[model samples]
Target: MVAPLSAWPWENFGRFKYLLYGPFLAKVVRSRFQEDGPEDSNWCLHILIICALRGLIHQLWSSYSNMLFLKRNRRIVHQGVDFKQIDMEWDWDNFIILQALIASIACYIFPFLENLPLWNTKGFIALLTLHMAVSEPLYYWMHRCFHGNHLFTHYHYLHHSSPVPQPFTAGNATLLEHLVLTGIIGIPILGASLMGYGSISMIYAYVLIFDFLRCLGHCNVEVVPYQIFETIPFLRYLIYTPTYHSLHHQDMRTNFCLFMPLFDSFWKTLNGKSWELHKKISSNLGKSARVPDFVFLAHVVDVSAALHAPFVFRSFAAMPFSTNLLLIPLWPGTLSVVLMMWAWSKTFVYSFYQLRGRLHQTWVVPRCGFQYFLPFASEGINKHIEQAILRADKLGVKVISLAALNKNEALNGGGTLFVNNHPNLKVRVVHGNTLTAAVILNDLPKDVEEVFLTGATSKLGRAIALYLCRRRVRVLMLTTSGERFQKVQKEAPMDCQSNLVQVTKHQAARNCKTWIVGKWITPRQQSWAPRGTHFHQFVVPPILPIRRDCIYSDLAAMRLPDDVQELGCCEYTMERGVVHACHAGGVVHLLEGWTHHEVGAIDVDRIDLVWDSALKHGIRPVSSTKAKTSQ
Candidate 1:
């Protein structure tokens, strides 16, 4: 049986009115024969074209608008929003095609009944009122259901994946989820038509308006004027703005309603910060914005202390619990147990902080200790380093300095693994070893004709050795392996190798005037140095203590200027207070906006330039020797 025309008051319009409703009339005539059955190819095709066109238009308009706004006022743009996520991939393209097909099929089956005189004012009002009254309640529940743990993981999580929602993200959903959403909107229109309360014109208008609002809600950019809501308090309840919808994406538990906040308010799921966030974003309209420049310094944890204390405490406690149970006094046994408990407690607390991914902020730069022990290039250490990089990226940090172990882990290709793994990451990673080498080389005493270089196999160690050799200083290379030492000597220039003297024994370094310990030097090794020898300890998590007779210095520290120095909240210490030369390299790169600098081995000639850039950003190097001497 044929579906009857919608018996609305607007249907009373004469045939002449059909000119104003040409598309609807044409659809009606084309759909007449297939009305006897549910299957209507002509009606389905028309609906598909309409929906596709609507989607296309929304995409084009939103993209154009975003480009214009970004060019004019970039500061107002959401920093967290990675536009790379919005690019159409194979899966996204397939999902969009499926959604369009499903929506078209659903629309043809539960079609909005036709009516004449398309522009009747009374009918339009009634249609919108019924649509809102029905759709809002249904959508609110459906959306809430989508947020349920099981459903969200399987279906709705895709849509919420973009923390900063964009216009394209509005329709990015699973096929079943999209069908449910489309049904919520289409059902109300169909019900209005079935009840003879809606004209074809009214249904068309609702669909167009709904599509427009849907796009606006997910645009990330807040377009609603703050004055409108302040002037008309009730309007907030009636209309859901872009900021209102963005909060829903950020936090799925609240703001469930699609178009209006009436249901959300009644249900008390409305986000409290929605209005505040909206106002904050709105205030940035038309303002110029730029990404803030900052450096992320990855610090090393004292692994030897962490490892040794635990082992010693465990051994001491074991004596009490085992063979020494009878030999040891009761007080000694109790003390050993107490010490073990304290050591384990400390380790547990420190481990908790590491797992928490806490970032320590300084006046000029941010630091995060990987909280791992030395020999930092293991799989476990690399994982933590990756986490640190990810954390830096999330903080909107533009550049990251791989300090200490971090540099070793990222040394080969300069964090190429991280760069490859995290394609969406905007933060640049640097090994900063070049600048560290520069600082050490520049500070080398001119009078010292001979220098002992240890850990020559390492990237930083080799770089420093070559730099010293270039300065015509005689280099005594000390390492555990004689073969590796010879390999390092072979790789150096003829003139550099001519000055290199490989020494397998630590005692061989005694006669050297300057001891440049790059890495792998323990306190025992440090003791091998003769009294009054100039000792430069460059390894992070410094293994050697300050000696009264020896001239001891750590890595060169960055000195901050007076004005910008006040910006950081944390105080600097000799060990932690001064930024390492490696970290300063990254800070300079960020401040200069130079993306192409070689991270692992920065040009030695650029040392002064990098140092100047660091100073410009308020980072100055304090003498490590001076700081140690005062202590």
Candidate 2:
């Protein structure tokens, strides 16, 4: 059964809900244009600020809570946030928008509210007193009532749907629950106003404090120092800890207080183990987190994509990464973060998941994709990669795979520099390009006898050319350097050498229907291919589909095995449960328990073996139809 107030009227609008403030925004702009001085009341602007502030407060707590390195073991929930829960809570700030509109209407109806002073010390004191006297107990009882059989099933269950509670979970309630919450929240402010003790500062302070406590309680990681309760034992009754509220989520009948445990204590509903668990979690604050079995070393693509990092936005990170206009406002802050990372230049854990009972994590080198091209940044990038490898070796990690530009030949010689420098390393270092070549090769049709290959003398290109030629397919290897071309051509058998033909111009592949793009191509170059030519790409940023008749594929990727568990985040632009071929390659190495470091050149002989092993482990390729859409 659905409650009458279960959904918002503008819920379907999605991100367009920001348009709700258009009229109020126009009013402020008009006031500014008309040169309305301090005499003109800007109550609408004040309400907007308060609403924005509340939302920011929630975001700050969420960002801090998700920092895994800060307090790993203190986290109440170990599971990652999945796309389903992310979608459900994407509109977590809906309550703020609703209250903003309500406040605007109130100001219009009760004109006196528009003239409230900016600061009033007495009003602030009265707001706090009223919140304690009326709001707290009222909310405690209201919360208890909602947990009853009828309301729990219809109205409150949605709020508790997320098994792993987060900061936004505080506001991820149904419209019906917010209706009651809005009233519980409004009483203190309305009472203070009605009693001749209300001001703008009072409203701001009360709402901000309310949001702060709400987010504090739901943040899965416990931040309140346990010694605070030990120093003043009775203070525990006045304030609730994250663990206290987490207990209510675990055993819903207990610890029902809103922000203070006094109400729960009075009602005999406080969980007895709350204090004990809090102390236990606090003990782990200074300890080192557990080591991961596998680590995929990655780097940021750009400032826009950086916001899609798991710690930045759970909802955004859960989906495929893309640049959006809404992210423009955040660019300045993101740039600052980039600068800081460049100065520090160290590796940090970005995200993690469990696979077959083993912990796998993605650790990012503090460098962007473009930075690898910079002459000065290359040394720093390599240093960070080496540091991460050494750290993984020290921690006893089984395998660490280099991703994207981190394994670039120009930057680190396909991760050969570190392997040579540390030959005694126990942890296997893998560039994972062999699997990358296999994924691109396996995607081609069995009848692809003659193919045009771009970047033909490169690491993956060479492997691909050799693999195809051995199967009696003619490979047109495009390259500007004859020395590099001949070096690769000679690696093939004498009979297959005839299959590898060196070409220098786009016109050379004009008649080839099978195109394997290992390098970027121009619109004019793409036009050289005949109609119905399917371009199998391994290029970064992928190529544009200029020809309407021709098809273009995305970067190589494979869907993980069905037994892979808790895979809650999309890998870059890859769909859910899908990962770059390089990432899957590392997993295959760990599963096979390969001791040799798979660095430097990609071994052509093992290409088929790696592909078969991936399939044997249930890792499947992205369907051609599905791969096209990712582009």
Candidate 3:
């Protein structure tokens, strides 16, 4: 439980804490518009810009540090950041807002601070000197004091609570700790100002460098090459590396320096293995990569959805995904990134988690979902998927599951094209449609006699229809092609074939309570279902809920078993710890050690087998509420 005094005043405000800056923004706007404004000359505006810049710096570092492609071998912490840590560090920049408010008040009270010049060499030098002489030592000792029994429990424990530190960890602290940090940080700027030499540039330079070093230390990736320290032995003591600070988190008694290790050396508190461990880690940076036992191959949904990738926004990706105002400004840059990915056209690892000591990773194709629907994009999309499958085979991956449109029948024939092209391949290619069909099938009440199926001729649709008919349940297969419908109908037993009925319009399902939706449906089409009808969806970008009186299920998904570890990211809009059914299908395949390639059309015979195997392995459905609502 949090001590009431240690918690931030706006702790419960969540994303709305940005509103704390509203007053400062309103004042700046008033100053700009009013004819007789306080002549501070937009200093407040400059402060806001600098604050934003600091936030951007932290965001960039978080993205870069978590990028598995860039520095997999050099990652100091092998585990991913979980939702709990993301929430704890969500308000990492609260101090920046608090300081901005304080600075605004200060400018109002002080006269000489009205219109400082842009640059002052003397002030810059003075602040740097003060930082080295006064700030560093004071922070070193204060940081050590926080490690003591009393303060550690009361305040500093919050900082160390993040076992796998990221850039934001630098500023995630209790309110009391932040207050001390604010004072420690302000010393140099105030000292410079008091000594009659201060400039806007100096202020910017000092605070940026301070934040840069702080984030650098906490970023779990080892970025600074070891050669720099070896070349100048003195510089080793003068500056601290990311590895040096990571050691402090590992063993709290050593390496308590701020940005400089000189203070730690003076007190014999520096860890001896810092240099050696850093060199060992840095030497292996790009020479090797981690090979996973299972890989779930996925594609982007759209430009906005791409931002939810693990490497983009840590906090946004940790939660059940949604479109919010935060994504609007990032759209243009993300669109550029998407275009670049298309040009590059390579598969890259997106995120990973471990279950029972086996590694499971999600790798993404460069193509978006909409691109797969285009006539010309099919060849390029297949090329990327094929290359990814071949790459996984070469890397000794055990099983690779195709997700979303990556396994589309029109695109790669449900991943059969690649498997047939490379018969000698050892890795199993799975479309995961077996488990997908099973999830959607099992979600219906066991007594559900009739289910209206759309997209009835598609791979999943065909499998679902055959499986239900074999159970002697009535299946309304909605498809325009009678030939395709007959093809699926023949797959069922002769006695059960009579249970499968062909329907050309949604009007046929008006009386059915269990509607299995396999294709996109508009409000008009959906209105055909009766008032209590439950819409079980296997569609991409799930259909909107237009019927307030009806229930709508999320896309087929399963919650991972409790033994899974480091599962920090939600799969698309799935809730935390839950993954799309196909992704879970791949996981089940790996666990069962099933040698057969599960591509092409799903086997109706194995639907019950796969569903039972998934249950045995503890992968379960999304909760009733999560499955029943679009949220």
Candidate 4:
């Protein structure tokens, strides 16, 4: 019988996804904590880490080696390179690894490159001969073919454009060319050994030597002794010269052998070349990577975190207290109502989402409602909170803060969780500099609808409650804390929107099917929105609000959503590819709020029962409430 077929073959294929995000994430952690030590040490560490990683990965993937061999991500190079030679054009690292990625994956699906019988199982020498005869020739030939397709220049040009190649520059290629290269280079080895012309282990070694030498061939060294090469003609016969490889970058038509001078000799494309561009290429690369010794991942994290201050301010500002107002004169009595739900928070949340950087990464695009195997979000939940705000038809949600409400002269400690004589709800803003979350609560709203919650007295929670606590509106909180946080999944709170029949959050209330979230959060969360209902309850964000006076940066990854057909008068039209880090003199975009949530209220009179509900769930009410009863 023929050998067994693979059942769950691609299962381990997920390993490839790791490389896509692993380095950036590692870089983030390293940047935040570890300094890269000395330059020589840094190089040594990188080399060691790579070598160790390669060994472990190869072993771990050996059983599933067939799959890893085929994947686009499994690589011999430190990084990927895009095919574009124009240094200014490549937006990020993914473009660099394009070739190796394309090649690896194709081999997984179709092991075509070294497909010849009798070449496998004959042992090391036979395997070496077959690999040398086939894989090298194929790599050279296809490497040459990639140059001919002018329209295909996007893939090939990027490879040669690296006048100075870094370890990371190895993987770069246009996605398509990556696939082509993988097919030509990887398949033949697998196919040949399968036909029994040689042993797989020998072929493996040959492939390793070929790759290691090729990398060394692109040297940034000035110490190569041309005198020795001139002395040993047989050595010239044995090894590929540094100048020979660099010449390929200069002229695409010749010098294609990646291993020995086999293909070049057979095809009459060999030249006795020498290494001279070493210093120039190294200098160029050094100048180009001038982004402070930190890895690119560090830069991205810096940008994303740097963006948080504005996002936080904008999100906090869109509070009902500031955005909407229904001065009920500290009175009571209101009718069952219709809520005018306009999320004042649209811009801020969208801006935060856009600037969060993780969304702009390659992973978010496919998230148009699909379970993509994100490299970074493996175990973490979404970090950003999502919610909706409902404004009553005649009774809009008003807001204040804990610090503003309490007027606590308790600038020096010592205070109990006291319930005050506030009518509607108290929005408290913090002012003082005390420890235990410096927030105070007082002065309330009346006839408020029910109050919806993601969790408890997170200082800001009291401020939000005071803004929306109208008299009769009910308050229902899906407690997000401790054990409860684990129970309340990301979708749990978003699902609260459905629990809300006639309540809305947000003050600059525009009519929309959306909810605004307060600072309600949980333990398990990722940088992106979680894949749950508390998340689904949040509305799909409209594209970011771009305006003319504002300079739009990060446009390479920006575009209109797929659904919008009519190109209405958008204030900012992305006319060309965005050159990143372009200094914008002023505020870029007017952000509203990132995570919007629903708001409602239970009568403060019934708030005792609410306390009971909270206490029963082991959650103390956000702030103690003193209500006027029907006495």
Could you tell me which 10 consecutive residues in candidate 4 have the lowest summed lDDT? 581-590
Q: Which candidate is the best by TM-score?
A: 3
How well is each residue in 326-400 modelled by candidate 4, as lDDT tens digits?
324211211111011011112011111122121111101101112112445321211110111111101121221
Q: Which pairs in model 3 have colliding backbones? A: none
- Give all candidate RMSDs, comma-separated: 24.0, 2.7, 2.3, 23.3
What's the TM-score of every candidate structure?
0.43, 0.94, 0.95, 0.30
Better of 1 and 4 by TM-score: 1
Query: What ordering of candidates by lDDT runs from best to worst?
Result: 3, 2, 1, 4
Candidate 2 C-alpha lDDT tens digits along 1-631: 4468888889989779999988777787788877763332398788778888998898888888877756566887777666677778889999999888888777766677887777877887888888788988999999999999988988899899987888899999888889888888888888888888888888888889889999999999888889999999999999998999999999999998888899999999999999998888877764546679999999999888889887787777888988779889999999999889878877888888888888899998888888988998888788899999999999999999999899998888899999999989999999899999999988899888899999898889999999999999999999999999989989999988999999999899889988999889999999899887889988887888777777777898999887776566788888888999999999999988899999888999999899999888888998754222222
Q: Point out where model 1 deviates above 4 Å.
A: 1-291, 297-384, 387-397, 410-414, 420-426, 575-577, 601-618, 626-631
lDDT scores for all predictions? 0.58, 0.87, 0.87, 0.31
- Give the per-residue lDDT of model 3 (tens digit) for 142-249: 998999898899889999999798999998988888778878888888888878898888888888888898899988888888999889889988878888899999
TM-score of candidate 4 versus the correct structure, residues matched by position: 0.30
Off by over 4 Å in 2: 30-41, 286-288, 624-631
Q: Which pairs clash (backbone N, Cα, C closer than 3 Å) in model 2?
A: none
Candidate 4 regions exceeding 4 Å error are: 1-16, 19-122, 149-154, 197-200, 222-224, 271-631
Between the candidate structures 2 and 3, which one is better when assessed by TM-score? 3
